[model samples]
Target chain A: MTATKEHVTIKGNKDGLVFLFNDHCEFPDLLSELQYKLEKSHQQILSGPTIDVHIKLGERELDVQQEEEIKKLVGHHGNLLIQSIESTPKEQIEKNIHQDLKIMNGIVRSGQSIHEDAPILFMGDVNPGGMISSNGDIYVMGALRGLAHAGKNGNKDAIIAASYMRPTQLRIANIVSRSPDESANEGAYMEFAYLDEDHMQVGKISELHKVRPVALQF
Target chain B: MGEAIVVTSGKGGVGKTTSSANIGTALAILGKKVCLVDTDIGLRNLDVVMGLENRIIYDLVDVIEENCRLAQALVKDKRFEELYFLPAAQTKDKDAVQPEDIKKIIESLKPDFDYIIIDCPAGIEGGFRNAVAGADRAIVVSTPEISSVRDADRVIGLLEGANIKNPKLIINRVRPNMMKSGDMMDIDEVCAILAIDLLGVVPDDQQVIKSGNIGEPTVMNPTSNAAVAYRNIARRILGDSVPLMNLDGKKGVFNKLKKIMGIG
Candidate 1:
């Protein structure tokens, strides 16, 4: 620590290492300290199996160039992959916007697909052979008799809901389930599918809040 | 001015050509000047279905390629003075006719006919696009089979995307018995899935196949139940209110009795 002001600190955990930079210090000073610390650290600490490195920029704003410089500096160290750069309010707002629920009107026809990183609310029917995939949850206001894949990239929290849940197939994260052959023509009611203990489960939509509270968070 | 209607189904053998032939013939029987255009290209069958294959001297490609005039290419129907058939070129592929060329051909034919029915080839390919390019309306044909309904849904979606709005649905080859037994999809289910206006439902008829074999449309057979369904569809197309034919087989005996008595 130079002059008792530690601008950068590196912590390791089971998941990966974390680079915490002090927001009080000037960005140039923090960058230099991070560079010096990585250079002086024991080779073994940087040379281990490839692991994620999360950079926490608490209350600090970084322009595009400064962020790139930080990434390059960390990448110079061995086996350290920059997984994410997390800042507070700005990043959170941007994330919320990206995860915003997108509404689409009209039917998804056979061989048609809608894939997105955000949650999707389709207002019309998803015909057989149609597909809808998302990294977040999927909500269909009309019949969903086609394929639906939610929580892509192993986001186990994602859910798939439909007004008429007679889906040909449902996929959540890494799990998949096909509808039963008989698919009783129960009067159209809202229903949903989610991953429970790594298994796929279907239930009435009213129980969604109790099952996945995050889904009700808007 | 004539209105061009494209009859299409995304899946093959769902009776696109058969519906085209029958609808065109029905329109002609209604005393409308009608022309049938076969846009199936190399796999042309509308001419054969209409029993005009023997008269296809100059095909659609000949007119578009300027080898012959449009009038020179159209073959007049033997039975109807107002009905004409434009056969597709058997040797050339779908790429032979461009969308612009079809639009121009339909525009030219519009002034001379009351209706121009274009038989679209199965599948959403260049041929389908070419057929739909000039149509002011569309008729999507589907059987009561799951595969046919799925394909019809796809074609209807494509038609709407192409700005051919409100495409009518024809549930062809319906088996009321199988539907009652829950073995086949019903007309209501098909209409719900496709979400389009119902044009007509032609029940499964052995005579349809026999008529095709003899190069005659079932719509020409007055006694055929499918023929009545086609005529009702034609009247509906003319903006005449026609009730849907009762598909319940229970009406068969009663109808036969009525016909035999001639209402006494």
Candidate 2:
């Protein structure tokens, strides 16, 4: 095969070494490529004390037999350990390239805190005195009665959405906003809070779907 | 196996010691041999509340440190023959005793007593963990105030995390008049917030203070409303389906009026 016909690529990452396989390649072709690459770098890779090899299957799910086959193939190469296998779907890999979404199911009680790197989907009520902070957006299926701090990493585009948005305190990025004098009326509809210019603004969830007309620049 | 129940309140002055003394006494009165273990250590108050402070020769630390036998530390109650109290050491702090130490102490006491009531200290620190470590069930005490209820919620979460499942709640110091006027949160509201089963509701009764001053739990005084509440709580703890006390204190009059008015 020519140098351009590369189907398997090996690279080092913060979490040990990773082996990437092209989705379009056949299983046999991918295995042969992996074997060839390992054979070439076997001396250098196997020199260290049992290093973990993270196998990244791009857009391809591995069955138990295929995983066992890959494990057997890697074992023949040397003392390298297969730490984990990451098989990413095409849609999810494309949508949340940088965002991590965590879905939690339970009530966030008083004095309890939940912190996440990316967005969070809470399936329960955030009670009074509870806190939830996220780097990206936060979606609560139940009442958001406690403190919610979204866009914690200074990403102002992050929004907080809840069925009942009567939060004790709502913070987006650097700006902080408390509940209004009279708490917002609780209804069947969902509410969203987002950063508008320098201040935080609360609106109906439907407002997010509406397209705002851009100001014409002469 | 004997049931070891820990009476805990995350916030102080919510009547954890009082509940322990009374519940242990009530259980003893119900013909069950009960021992109250005061695990507060430094700020020990269960012995004082149980009126056996002067009788404490060997405290809980003595039992764990092998300074004395477990039987030597148990002080017999003057009122109930079956009721006993294990006082906590006032000089030593919480770190003096580990959770495993408390577990071993309770395990030794298990065969002798029918119910081991542990009076847990306020706050979710080492002392609280030590108290709850040995207990099979837990009773969380909270007042009607927001601060007490909030702390109780936190304590409940910690209890569940510690694998103490389905801890019962006791809403103490509930003022019915304030509840009627919407000034204080009602029992139902507190129950809703905590999301725990209501074991009992002790109305704000002046008799509780009077009894505590004399080193007597109100559960001893049959006439006192708080005593009745504590007895009902004890019964519930025994798996009896006792209905919650009507805190309004006008259950009889209200029922009579409703009957006369043909509303009931």
Candidate 3:
């Protein structure tokens, strides 16, 4: 199809709204023109304190790398200048998740740490080197292979639950399980460990005194 | 239709350099044009592993930032005539190289070589992002240990999130004897969780370390179990249906690819 006359297209990247330049204009020139256009376009967007706008130029075949780079750069700054119709999505694991983090998946890998102000519940395993710290309680649907520390700020009432609980180390409030008993070799079952009258004890993950936490807002 | 593959493990010390050197060397030895881009930046050893560290006159950062021509920075492998090593700068930080710079460099390489294997730095940071910038495929290298496996799972998740479904696995340094002895997790045990296709299983061979010290890829030495495993992985990457090098002699083709990639 023939190019739209003076094409001004808008799209959503990981950062926010991005306006691309067609082959019609030069990159540096187009960038300057975009600033002028945004300055003149609408009032509501201009009313914001700051805005993030990502731009990429050249005849490059827009790939994921380019998209992610623009995003990281924009996010490094502040909010966007344009009130775009499209929105940049926050990470799924943290959406509307406050007070307690509910990571539906298991096996929190390395380079991924869930540091929230709430409790964390995993329906799966927390693999080694992956970290989990919470203010309320910590729960794992599967195994707890990685590091799980509950009551990080000294909430001794905090507890940890897992289906197959064999973590490298465990900590509740300030007390930590440096070395637990040898992991069982039989049918690996669920277990929950908590401060039983200030003494650490283990039982089935379901048998422990726990409250089913509803999702909280950010 | 050439491509670059970043062999990455989200966690460190999971055999990214070893696999990069071996796979790049294997492809070259197989008579395919290959260039190994060391995206590790600041801690590069692709040159050393290929036994060509002494010949690194220039680095990848230089080539990308237009300081040197791509041809000037490439160091030919000591063994394979077709293989070239592009080492990363030992002093510069990862941020010195942008994702676009890496993408431009790889795009320039796509037409010249049959394969470009990028030895990605550990973690999902800027370096990891830069390493994977322009690659057509990815290979997440990991070991049997829970730490490595967990990291591999996260790396796989990142790859999937990037829509890179062709990511394969090279479970390195696995001791089959230990698997038999119940001391180590078997290939099946790992496959059941990570759920990615198994390219090859490298038996824990001592030659891997020795080869690294001498600046030679283990695959260059035919005797090492690691070498055979690396070669099998190269074959698998080429869309060849080579069987898994089973020391116990009891693994299957379908089962290997079944769990990983969630494919048949």
Candidate 4:
């Protein structure tokens, strides 16, 4: 007896695999199948050390529940890879992007221009010359050295989050922010960006509600 | 060991493929086995620039993806015994290949050649990663324009982060007259900002376009100004201290005309 080996269309990327198949499969069934196969080879090394991945959905469409299911299976703060979106409609694609999370992976090279309008989650290092524009909250799970702009749509309530934040230039909408000087480039903690009554400021995510001095110590 | 050097410029229309073809042909003339691998995938132009597209039986994707054997994928140059062309797949995009897959392919070629020159595709995406993955060294090809230089600077950081350390630079399409008159940014300023070692400077030469149309690398045309620059870079690659080609003076009549019109 032959098992129905699903006609999985594998779209390869720099970091990992993007499996495009039917949305009819149950969430548990899909997750189990992926786990059964991936864990066989990845059992030795599949946690942490997030690898950036992109899912380019050019033709196929995915439901909201399936998207959420996939996200749950991948787990938060895990190795990130972009999934199919080109195939999905623009609004759906925008809605599917992690609004509260910034997804960036790989080294952001100089002159490499990047503009994302979603709440961003980056898994890679932001090198010197790159720039990102996002409307929602931006979170960096890695080092950010390039010019990054959060709340580009003039949302005064937005914040920029990073695991390592030493931006050459930071902007939250019209408000301009600068790095803490070349000598003060050590950022080992997660930082967040928000607007004050008249000034746009960034503070540690843990201390978002807490009040501190006008000028940050960092 | 024969080194694989990927000539990349992330921004499109910046002559990445043109520079790769010229440099590969130049290296072969120096008696080194050279293979130019076009990793541009779906938007390949190296074969067309080299005038070898019609002769291609397979491509770089076919060899690595196991659609064909390496020997079958390699298209030998008509005139040079040491030169070969590995074209890209016109049907597939950057996603068809990966960095690891490219590394595996280059590792296999280590024992057989003196140089594996990859023509990197535009963008910092999959094609870019695959091209640079197997490269022992990289030559970022860029114009004198600020945008190109800026992108080149970013590419340098990318290469460094990937541990391809100390990638040499090739500044192409330099119009010395423009720099002399302050119309264009001089190479010195570009070098100062990027702080990378210089490989060689190629002057603007119309023969480069004509040569491409004829399926020939400018370097093969001995008298072409740009060819002299590519030849100089090839020599520099082999540890030879050849002088850089000057912008205005070369054997080409077209080059001379450009000097008269102050266009080059």
DockQ of each: 0.52, 0.53, 0.28, 0.29
Highest DockQ scorer: 2
Off by over 4 Å in 4: A1-218, B248-264
Error of 1 at B163 (Å): 2.2
Model 3, position B256, has a per-residue lDDT of: 69
**Residue B237 local lDDT, model 3:** 83
Worst 10 residues of 2 chain B by lDDT: B255-264
Candidate 2 lDDT (Cα, 0 to 1): 0.86
Model 2 reaches an interface RMSD of 1.0
Q: Give the alpha carbon lDDT tens digit for every residue of B70-163 in model 4.
A: 8888889979978988888998778888889889888887678999999998888778888999999999888888788778877787888678
Rounded to one decimal, what is candidate 1's iRMSD? 0.9
> Could you give the fnat of all candidates in order?
0.71, 0.59, 0.53, 0.71
Candidate 3, residues A1-218, lDDT tens digits: the string is 13434434545566755666554554444444444455555334545466556453434333566445444433443445433223223443354454246556645754456765677767765666678878777878776767888888888877887777767778888787744465543324677777866677777656553432432222
For this target, which candidate reaches the highest TM-score against the unseen true structure? 1
Which candidate comes out best when scored by lDDT? 1
Q: Is candidate 2 or candidate 3 better by TM-score?
A: 2
Per-candidate Cα lDDT values, in order, are 0.88, 0.86, 0.75, 0.76
Q: How close is every model to the real structure, measured as TM-score?
A: 0.78, 0.77, 0.61, 0.56
TM-score-based ranking: 1, 2, 3, 4
Q: Could you tell me the lDDT of residue A7 within candidate 1? A: 86
As for candidate 2, its clashing pairs are none
Candidate 1 wrong stretches, greater than 4 Å:
A1-99, A182-188, B251-264
